[model samples]
Every structure is written in structure tokens, then in C-alpha cells.
Target: MRNLTVIIPTYNQKDLLERAINSLISKCNDEINIYVLVNNTESNYIVRNKNYANLHVEYLNTNCGFCKAVNYGLRLIKKSRFIFLLNDDTEVINQIDIDNIIHELIEKGNIFSISLKMLKGNYPNLLDDAGDMYTILGWQFKRGNGLPKELYDRPCEIISACGGAAIYNKKILDEIGYFDEDFFAYLEDVDLGLRALMRGYKNLYYPYISVLHVGSATTGGKYNDITIRLTARNSIYVIYKNLPLPLLIINFPFILLGYLIKFIFFAKKGKGKIYISGVLEGLKNLPKFKEKRRENMRKKKISNIKLEWILIKATFEYFHQYIKRAFYTLRGAKK
Candidate 1:
């Protein structure tokens, strides 16, 4: 049985997918199987991997989107102890980084996932993401996004692993369930992380384990109508699915404020309508999340107060970063 299996989900970037696969084949051991989920694409596009023995490809005729594609791939894997979700637009930087992540996973049974650090493609000095962070204000952001790569050199706990490149323990995933298909794409990883947290499992960021990621190769550039709609809609889904009744009511105002701010931001970018539509859609389908809410509530091992504290702390961290950025921007303007 394979100890680790890397799942790469691709939409139409055949070249990028091949590059990713080749990078892994060269850097990783031949024993590590690579499963490529070609979403809405022909399998013939991928050139035969004669050199790599453990490569597998699954072709989907319809565009099932990211969540469903990943879950579909997950369901097929019965032997792997760990599942590494990687984007087609990313390349493994070094085998040692992956080895470190595997070692960490083997050492820690309570860890649900390890989010590998990503350097922006072609700009190796700039950080793409360290890990994912969530706030009570219903905002999810990358922990070390757009910062210097050198700034984040330590491992730490995170709210979620960025789905682009992360290693998840199969056991924890089995216990907490896979990505919520209702999300279709956005914020689904955050929902998974919240479920793990509620079940007393820790998600981590290991900065030493890094990848080179060309962000958003499939969904167009970030802030497109599709991204805006799915993100807006899925944010609501995450909030609804994870929070219990009383906590939801308590955090309602902050969440509303977050949405309001996001609406204004996107409105300035001419995506306000798309954002509102997503939110409305999410609200319309709120009933669909009822079972998820009950499930999380039932399996919740962490105290309500602790969960609130986690969100509150993450919120404070967000504000601190916001203020720091604003200060630096002003300083640069003066310069």
C-alpha cells in the first residue's frame, strides 16, 4: 500500500499539468503514486508517462468543478494513508520538502493536514501562501500571502491548508468527511478545516515544505465572476455548516459586516452583482447545510468558547496585518 498519493486535478492546462507531473516524477520517489484527475478534458492530451510507473489518470467528461473532482478522486483511493492535493499549476520545488511533510504527518497523528508553503511562480522570492487563515468576520485569507518568502520560515498551526498544495491525513479525512460538494469550488477547504477543528484535529503550516504555484490557472484570474460568485456563496456555506445556532447568532453581526465590506469592495470592481447573487444563492440553499450543521455539532470535541476564541484571535491577527499593510503603503507613498 502506498503511504502517500498525490492527486492533481486539472481543467484544461495540459502543459501545466504535464510540467507538474514531470516535476514530481523527477523529484519524488517512484513508489509515490501520482493520480491525475483530468476534469472535463480528454485523457489523450496527457502524453504517456513511460518513465513513471505509478502514474494514473482519470478523465471526466463534464466539468464537475473543483470540489466534486477532488471528492471523486478521494473516493477512489482506498489504500493511501495520506492524500496530497496539488494544483496542476504548481511544481514541487524539492523532494526534501515533501519528505519533511511526510515525516511530520507520520509523527503527528492528531494533525489533520499540513499546508505546504508556495512560492509565486517565476518569482521564487515572493510568497504565494504560507497557509490559510479564517476570522470570525467570515473572512478567509492566506497567512503569508504576497510577503517575502524568507519571512515565513517556521512551522505553525493554521486554520486550513490551501487546497492548492497540502497533505491531508487520510484517517482524519475519513473521520471528518471529505470536501463538501455543495461548495462546487471555493471555500470548501476552509469548511473541511473547520470540521477538523471542531473534531479536535489540528491543521498546520510547514513553511519548509514549499512549491512553486502559478495561481488560478483554471478559473481565470482571481476576482472573475465565477470566482466571486462561488467564493461569496461558499463563504456562507462554511459559516452555516460549521457554526452552531448560538454561535452563529453571536457572530452574525461581524459576518454581516464582513459581507458588507466584501460587497463594497467587489462593487468597486464591478462584481457586486455576482457577489450578491452568490450570497443569495447560498441563503436559498441554507436548508441543504442543516445536516452538516447537525453533524458538526454532534462531533464537536472542542468547547464552544474555545472555538469562539480561535476565531476572535484570528480576527485580531487579520486586523493587525491590515493595519501593517496600510502603514507600509502610506510610508511608501511618502517615499
Candidate 2:
């Protein structure tokens, strides 16, 4: 197998970050290089303490968020052809066949990214993310999240690979460009994956490679003010930056409806004000996103019809799933 670089972006979670690095070191051979991008911190504990043959660490004085940190790491790795992005909160529980996966990637010419089977660390039986899926309403979801592990038994093609524990071909990033720094964090993976799709590249969900992720470890556990605000804000940017003008116009109603429903749902959780603030921020940055949209569209190799086929046709199905999950959560709270 060709030499691979694993980039782990971490914030203030030094203990968890150390554990994550140790897990990789245990499983990875000398051929694998681990790059830990310590974002916005002065902590040199990991750099000083962990002494491995292939480990390297870099620190950024300013907090640049997940997107920028990963991009910075990509720029730093000059030797490796394959790059794997892993979350600092994740742990590698099983043995990985890196050579076999690399061979599979070579065999599949169109594949630019591979999504690994990520199981929730807390609940070993449940999945954290199988891959990522995009809807016509401009929503991106974690495929098979919180579901039984046995459900996803086969390898298949997916719309996008989750940035938490996915591998990417360097050539694809060179062509389609890196993660949008403006995204900061949320939905940025979807934006990159969508861009890859537009440029006639494919993403695959490889069930063979696996990891354990403690979801949302850095951002205060999924639905906090920061998470909601950034997610709401970046969601708009993704829609504007990726879709063609015609498709954007066609999907406007559905997008509006989706936001409306999201507002109501978050309101139930007392996050309506934060969510609305994010929407306003997103709307204010429309001009910036429009420029990005124009830049991305110029590189399109796939037609709107072909892209439409890949997108989820019925947007309501996702909403239904959300409502069902919410209902169960509410019921459990009452119980």
C-alpha cells in the first residue's frame, strides 16, 4: 500500500486527543503517518510526550475551526498520496486493512472518497454515521445514524463521506478544491462531496474500515447554541454555493419549507432564537456565497439532471424521520 497520512484536527480536548492518537498508533504500521493539527491552543503535551516513528504535530495560535485546520494539514502533508481525516474524539477499535482498501480505491477509478463505518462509542451496537446523504431541500444527513450496525452490511456508493473518519484521494482535492474555510465547520464535508460529484467523481461507503466516534465532542454535544448557529448558517451557504441557478430556483420553496420546519422544531427545544440568528447571518452573507457559487459552477462536469438523480427526491421523508426521532425523545423524557 502507498504511504497514507492521517490528519486529526483537535480543539481543547487534549486528553481525548491523546487517546485518539494512541488508538491510531496501536493499529497503524510504520507506513502510516499521523498529523495532529492542534487548533487554537498552546498545549505541547502531545508533541512532547508521544514519541512515535511516524507522528507529527503542529499548533495554530488562532482558533480556525475544523475546516481551516484540515486545510492547513493538507497543505503541510507534501509526501502522501492518500489523506485520512479523523476526529480527535474518535477511536479505532478494529484492525484496518489499509492495503486492501487502497487496492479497492485504485480499482474504482471514479471514487474520490471513502466513508468508513463509524459506530457510536457510547452505544457500541449503534452507528454514528454510515456516510452522508444530501436532500433536494438542501439538507445533509448522516446516513444510518443511531441505527443498528447490522443494517449496513454491504459496501455501496453514497452521496458523501463524513469528514470525521473518511479517506480522500489527493488528486480529487487538487481538482475540486479543499474544504471551504468560510464554512468553518458544519456541512463543509457535504459541500466538498457535492463539488466532487459535480466534477464527475464518486464517493463510496466502505463497510470494511471502521472507527468509534464520540459524536460532537468538541462543540458541546450536537445541539448547543454554537452548533445550531453554525449549522444553520452554513446550511444556507452550502445550498447557494453548490446548486445551479435553475435548480436553486426550483428548490427554493422546498428549502424555505425545510427551514420553517427546522425553526418550529428548534423552537420546541428553546433554540429558536439562536437558529433564527444564524439564518439572518447566512442571508446577510448571500453575496459572498453567490461569488463562491459562480466559482464552483465554472468547474461543473455533470448536468443538473444527473445531479438531481443523486439527490433525495422526497424531502418530506427526512422531516418525517426527524419528527419521529423527536417524538420518541420527548416520550422518553416524559417517562
Candidate 3:
């Protein structure tokens, strides 16, 4: 079996997709299989181009969101030991240390995944993401977003590896589950990571490997209606699917506060109504996510104390970075 299979999910960005594929072809070993899972795009965009040796394209007629696109690729290449999920808008900036990543996965039996540090395109000092972070408040955020790239150089355990550019141990993923298709687009990685934790597996941040990312190239720069709706709704899905009833009660107030803060923030952006609709949509679908929680309960391996502490640490770090980012913005303004 091939040791690694790379899946790049794309939606309507033909030129950028070419760049991402070429970057991998140049940097990665030709033996590694690369799957370009093309989501709703023109008929001949990918087909017209001459395919490379180890690269394959899977074309879809409908616009399946991130979760389904990735899941489809997983189904196609199920035997690979490690799977790397890369975003079409990203370019591999260095040779992927496949041996090191595989060694780490093998040496550390509990690690489910590893995130690659991503810097903003053309600005090596600016970070796209170090990893994904989750807090007790039901918030999932990108660690070290827009901060100096050097600030997040150390390796550490993260709440989740950003699905955009992370490597997963296919065996563990098969055991826990693939990305939840109900998520459709957002917060799905957090749900997957939480599930991994429940099964006593770690998700890590490995800073030695990196990529150049053009963030939000597919979903329209961060705050669009589509992203807002999906993120708002999926936040509730995350809390519902992972946290048991007791834990949910303990975190309720903080989670509510988080939602309120986000509501006001979106209100300022004229998306308040849209955000509320999304929340209502999530609440409406509670029964399904609750069932999912019950199904996952039997697999819970990590103790309650450790889980809570992980969230508490993430919450404090979130606020710490928030304050530091504000300070940096103020300093920049003064200059």
C-alpha cells in the first residue's frame, strides 16, 4: 500500500488549483498519490489539462462542501496509511518531510493528526494558521492567525489540526470516523479532533513543515453570508455532538456568552439576522446531533477533568492572543 495519499479539495478556483498541484509535484515524491477532488466547476477545467503521473482528478457535478469532498476522496483511496488534506488555494512552500511525519505518527501511537504551519502568500513573516484551537465557549479559531510566523514556531498539542493543511493517520480516522458530513463546511475539524480526543488520540502542531496559503480563496474572504451561516450553525453542532449532558451544563453560560459576543460582532457587519437564523437552524436540528453524542459516548476514553482542562487552557490562550493582537494593532496605528 502507498504510505501517503494527498487530497486537495477545490471549488471554482482553476488557476489556483494548478498552482497547488504543481507545487506538490515539484516538492513531493512522485510515488505519492495526489487526488484533486474538484467540486462544482466548469466541465473541462481539470479534464482538459494533461494529468501527471501520480495525480488523479475526481470531478463532481454538484458543489459538495468541504466535508463531502474530502470524504469522497477518502473513500477512493482507503488503503493509504497516512492521508494529507491540502487546500487548493495553498502552495507547498518546501519539500514535505514525509519520512519525518510518518516517523512521528509511528513513534507516537496516540497522535491522530499533525498540522503544517501555513504562512500567508508572499509574506513569510505573516501566519495563515499554526493550527486550530477550541475553547470552552464553543468557539473554534485558528491559532496564530495573522501573527508573526515566528511566534508559533514551537511544536505543541492543538485542539484540532486545521483541515486545510493537515496530515491524518488513516487508521485512526477509520476507527473514530471521517469528517462529519452534516457539518457541510465549517467547524467539522473541531468535531473530528474532539472525537479523536474522546478515543485518547492527540492532534498535534508540527512547525517544521509549512505551506503558503491564500486564506478564504474559495468561500469569499472570511465574513461572507455562507461562511457566517455555516460557522454559526456548526458551533452549536460541535457542542451538541461532543459534550455530554453534564459537561454541556457546565459550559453553557460561557458558550452562551460566546454566541452573544459573536452576534453583536456580526450585527455590526450587517449579518445579525443571518447569524440568528443559523443559530435557530442549529437548534432546530438538535435531535440529530444529540443522537450523535450518544453514539460517541461509548468510545469516550479521556477523563472529564483532562477534557475540561484542555478547554480551559485553550480559552485562556485565546484571550491572551486576543489581547496581544489588539496591542499589536494599536502599536501599528501609532506608528
Q: Which candidate is the best by TM-score?
A: 3
Q: How do the residues 125-242 of candidate 3 rate in per-residue lDDT, one tens digit apiece?
A: 7888988988988898888887888899899999899998999999988888899999999889989999998879999999988899987888898899988999899888888888
Instruction: Please state the error at residue 296 of candidate 2 in Å.
Output: 1.7
All candidates' lDDT scores? 0.85, 0.84, 0.87
Q: Model 3, which residues run further than 4 Å from truth?
A: 47-51
Worst 10 residues of 3 by lDDT: 43-52
Q: Which pairs of residues clash in candidate 1, taking residues 3 or more apart in a chain or in different chains? A: none
Looking at model 3, the pairs that clash are none
Q: In order, how many clashes per candidate?
A: 0, 0, 0
Q: Using lDDT as the measure, what is the rank order of every candidate, best first?
A: 3, 1, 2
**C-alpha lDDT (0 to 100) for residue 68 of candidate 3:** 95
- Please provide, for model 2 over 1-335, each residue's C-alpha lDDT reduced to its tens digit, 9 standing for 90 to 100: 24578999999888888888888777764457888899877655555334676778888878899999999999988877889899999988877767777887744588899999999998877778888888887778887676668877788778789999999998778777899999899899999998998888889888876788998898988899999999999998888888898888887887888899899999999999999999999989989777678878998999998787677542454566567557756876899
